[model samples]
Target: MAHDALRDELATLTTEAADAALDDIDLVPTLEAARRMNAADRSVPAAIEPCLPAVAEAADRIAAAFARGGRLVYVGAGTPGRLGVLDASECPPTFGTDPSQVVGVIAGGDVALTTAVEGAEDDEAAAVHDLDALGLTADDVVVGISASGRTPYVLAAIREARRRSATTVSVACNAGSAAGRLADIAIDVVVGPEFIAGSTRLKAGTAQKLVCNMLTTLAMVRRHKTYGNRMVDVRATNEKLVARAFSLVQDVTGAPDAEVSAALEACDGEVKTAIAMLLTGVSADVARSRLAEADGSLRAVL
Candidate 1:
């Protein structure tokens, strides 16, 4: 009876529905299989188009929370969990945000990121425990991600977050899922069924990734983490980034390479500060002070 019930639930999931068009996928040649997979992937963006309004609204809520000194938190399990962690981890280097500003809570902890934690997604109690440990508050924004839109761990986290009065957003691949109903904003991309049937890590994963990317990127943009099209808040932590920093400074300021290098050094390798100094022909101290006065907006400082 339990097996039958589980089978029935799976059959109702959009992510689990078998695609009759790809019925002969296993028997196809390598090139044909690749082409078929690519064709399926192409529909992901279209599926997300209708969800733009919801995604933008969620981003605005997150940016407001950031302004109020609250954090953006992502909760999930399995592939959804890994995607949350991946996006959170990139915030610091990409937008120069503090590590604590964007947090990822995956069921079974960090260990679940690489290898599957058996039965982790089914533990609702563990989800509450994980979220509770984060010191959640009303100012925080919690994003719940689940391809099937019914992961117990993800739903539990959203519930706990809502209990704490935190703003909640849900990203799922199905319309009218429980997680979506529970969230303040529901971003249902509805990327249809997977090519391999029940393999959400394929099309569903792509839609989730695009939505997650938009949320964080737009939030950062709202917070002045970018100037025009440039990632002005980028942290130059390595050889490649350091080179890119010099390139960005020169491109934005139209200063000589040597002048850009000097400005960067004077500003302690801060890209936005260096740009301000070069553009305003001001001392590094004045540039830094002006940046602070303008709330770190490089455009205002220039």
Candidate 2:
């Protein structure tokens, strides 16, 4: 696209529009300026409310993919890309999922996470190359995230994902965006203009963060990673998490501390297994077999 055409396209984005009310923002008192910014930030959730159905639908698809041993992949640029990576990185530690189960593909690669890669988002072919590296298959779900919803890199990745028979979802901050038009499920947060003109790193970034959180967290829940709101699949790899695992086992089993500690030791610090053993007063081996039979669902085993 020519510079003028690109500029005109950006001009049409809600995120790029300058809020007239903020024209006098520089002239305001410090507290007043802060209040104005806070007010703008506070409207983000409501803006996202209308997009919940789409987010939920995409999450359902993601969960189904997980059940089939498939993955949920995020593709994006700039702040949106960073948010996707942040969310993807948390899944394994939080839900005990393999790193391959949830993945993030950012434009400009690892270098883009901290430094701006000039013209990276405009490289359509780069997006295809990144997704292709993942060996994407029909069971996978690729979510393209872009604040403007017109990012060529994100659009290309989504298009490529669909071409490979993978499910595609889009998260953008505009109505009827190109990314949305191409995706099976489109989530438009529509958070309105940024406090500073065209600076999508602000409210638009927050909206994408919120949606990513919802998507991945709920997908994990649907995959039986949680047991009645408790993170049963937690990997107790740290002191804090080990403590949490003990507490979880105790809470679920309501067993004496000695028995809980013994069960945990027998289960190799696996909280769900410990809980199953104590609650059912069964051997650790029996608990393990029951959990496996129940598809790792603690509630189902109980």
Compose the digit string of candidate 2's lDDT tens values, residues 1-302: 69999899988889999999999998999899999999999999999999989988998999999999999999999888999999999988789889999998899999999999999999999998998899999999999999999999999999999999999999999999889999999998898999998999999999999999999988888877899899988888899999898899888878888988899899898888888888888998999899989878888988
In candidate 2, the residue pairs with backbone N, CA or C atoms under 3 Å apart (3 or more residues apart, or in different chains) clash, namely none
lDDT of candidate 1 at residue 161, scale 0 to 100: 91
User: How big is the positional error of residue 17 in model 2, measured in Å on the Cα after superposition?
Assistant: 0.7
* lDDT digits (tens) for residues 48-141 of candidate 1: 9999999999999999999999999999999999999999999999999999999988988889989999999999999898878889999999
Give the residue spans of candidate 1 off by over 4 A: none
Whole-model Cα lDDT of every candidate shown, in order:
0.93, 0.92
- Quote the positional error of residue 214 for candidate 2 in Å: 0.8
Judging by lDDT against the true structure, name the best candidate: 1
lDDT of 2: 0.92
Residue 57 lDDT (model 2) = 92
lDDT of 2 at 248: 90
